[model samples]
Target: MPNSAAAMSKTGMVTKIHTRIRADPFSAHYELVGKELGRGKFAVVKKCIEKATGKQYAAKFQRKRRKGADCRMDILNEIAVLELAKANPYVVALHEVYETSTEIILVLECAAGGEIFDQCVADNDEAFTEKDVMRLARQILSGVAFLHRNNVVHLDLKPQNILLTSARPLGDIRIVDFGLSRRMDSITEVREILGTPEYVAPEILNYEPISTATDMWSIGVLTYVMLTGESPFLGDDKQVTFLNISQVNVDYSPDTFDGISSLAVDFIKSLLVKNPRKRATAEECLSHPWLNPHPHPHPHRHARSASSLDEPETSQSESEPDSPVPSPDLDDLIGSYLTCPGQGELKAGRDAFSFGEPPFPARPEIQQEVIC
Candidate 1:
């Protein structure tokens, strides 16, 4: 895949998958450097390394299609969301998008620490401090701020979608997997309902107008989920869940909700407002006292770290070193999706599927920088 704008024009979309990202090559151009980080219905994400940079990445290889796979549109919709969200630090960076005749390869940023869900769940009885919650809240606000600025609404915003760059001291935070993302205009609001079963706002369930505030509701749900492990509203059935949302059947049991701050709880109440018109903005959320309870100890002395200022990182590894991974035959995966000239080429976000080309040399000036 060439970086030339010509290639972009040829494909209609500016982003195209390079040759190095293909499923099969003579040798492992991009080695399977680590074990599978996670798996989804359509793809399996593996921790990988570019032989040239030795930098780690999470490679999500789309599983080969089987008969009766219902969410093909959803799978490609995720790709479109990734396309719109490329170059944003908070959003998972999509480096390369590859296609075999049968499967899609998405080379994405790897947040080594995994989902923030683990952090939220770590202290069983112990609750997250306001400071800790604020830190994550600010990062999430900044990320969602970017998406909102770009007019993309993340229908699904939860702890599971939030990931950490490092484990112990914690590191940069990123929002990943926008399979349910929707773009909206200033005056427009979506009526169609879409979102995770638990995090969805009341308005969404009622088929009300969706806006950036819809994301705000999800964020509120996320904040509550982070402070406490359980969801605000859970029911035995999907219909029941939707009913709870529509009816705002939120129970703030003091005994059940042990250790959560009243201010945190109040902030969630404000964000989870059934009417999207009244919901808080990302900026407003950042300004909430719950998110910034105390002033910085040394505001002037706290210059941002150089590393922190850099573009988001797409990979992370342990302080020691990761065990080597045995390379596997990508051909087995690629063979199914390889090109057939007579047939239509696979299309993803205006990029046409192409292979059998040479890898583009790394650009010195434009060194790959992690955005999260």
Candidate 2:
């Protein structure tokens, strides 16, 4: 018998032996092609090819140290979160990990279609119809639901973070970038001011404990932008934008949403609620009328604004009679929420009800890179 079996017999208890071997060094299996795909503050994603299988992948090279100190914990935390969500269809898959003397490399799936916003811009005239938006929205919700189910909150859920698998009709999507993701239990509350400015939830601005609702709020903003081609709370600058978000000021003028549907407006309102507890859950969002559209036999579909139909505007005095004074420190973090222009669009088919396979070319076997 093996030594482990012999020891188990001697002790009258089964002793498990760990026979797992470490994977070969990443450089041994893949070669960097010198083509840079994306760049960030501390990392650069480059195109790489596998030596043995000839498969393509995006290699994210992150520095092991920052300012002469170890910074691997951030990468490790991201890895842990990705491992828990590896099986999710909407999340980008992590294939391999490599560590070097001064950097860490992550081999990830390649999303050639690029950001959903790019598609929207490419097909400006025929922007994603309501049905197309529904399908994409459902996919995003599925990914978010998976993250929430695993006790992880994806603090950032914007158009920039959502990627398309191909440039074809109704292309599959993958949620990327989990640098701000946090793991939480049932009773634990996370209180960090993170996430992009226009998309950040009100709770984060108010300094309230954050939960899954934070992501839901972003989803609402994303949905609005996709439909109207404009941000609901985006201001001319950072301070105005932050003030708009904190005050929950939204514009639903007929001019802004001339061709939009009422059900779609309702869906956005459900998510953009100032109170986190009132925000819709991912599961609930999946069942929303906008996502799961029901045919209305009526001949005319009226476009309604949020102020006129759903949430009537209230004066600032009436809204915050007893609210505490704002803090300067929180205001500093709020600056990050400034509007990011030129975030491309999501492309979808005209017929929203048809769930046919997209006519996209087969994707290369390369890992996709997520921008942090």
By lDDT, who's the top model here?
A: 2
Candidate 2 lDDT tens digits, 34-79: 5566654466677788889887777777776754556566566565
**Whole-model lDDT per candidate:** 0.56, 0.60
**Residues 1-372 of candidate 1: C-alpha lDDT, one tens digit per residue:** 443221122111123322333446512557886556654334566767878778766666654453344333444445555666565556677766666766666666666655666656555433356556767777687778777876778776766567777655666677776655666765544564444557777765555666788899889877876776666666654555556777778767896457777888888888888878888888666656676555434332111222322233334422111111101111112111111123221111101111111111232222221100
Q: Indicate the TM-score of model 1.
A: 0.69
Query: How far is 63's C-alpha from truth in model 1 (Å)?
Result: 4.9
Residue-pair clashes per candidate, as listed? 12, 17
**Candidate 2: which stretches are off by over 4 Å?**
1-24, 294-372
| lDDT of candidate 1 at residue 270, scale 0 to 100 | 85
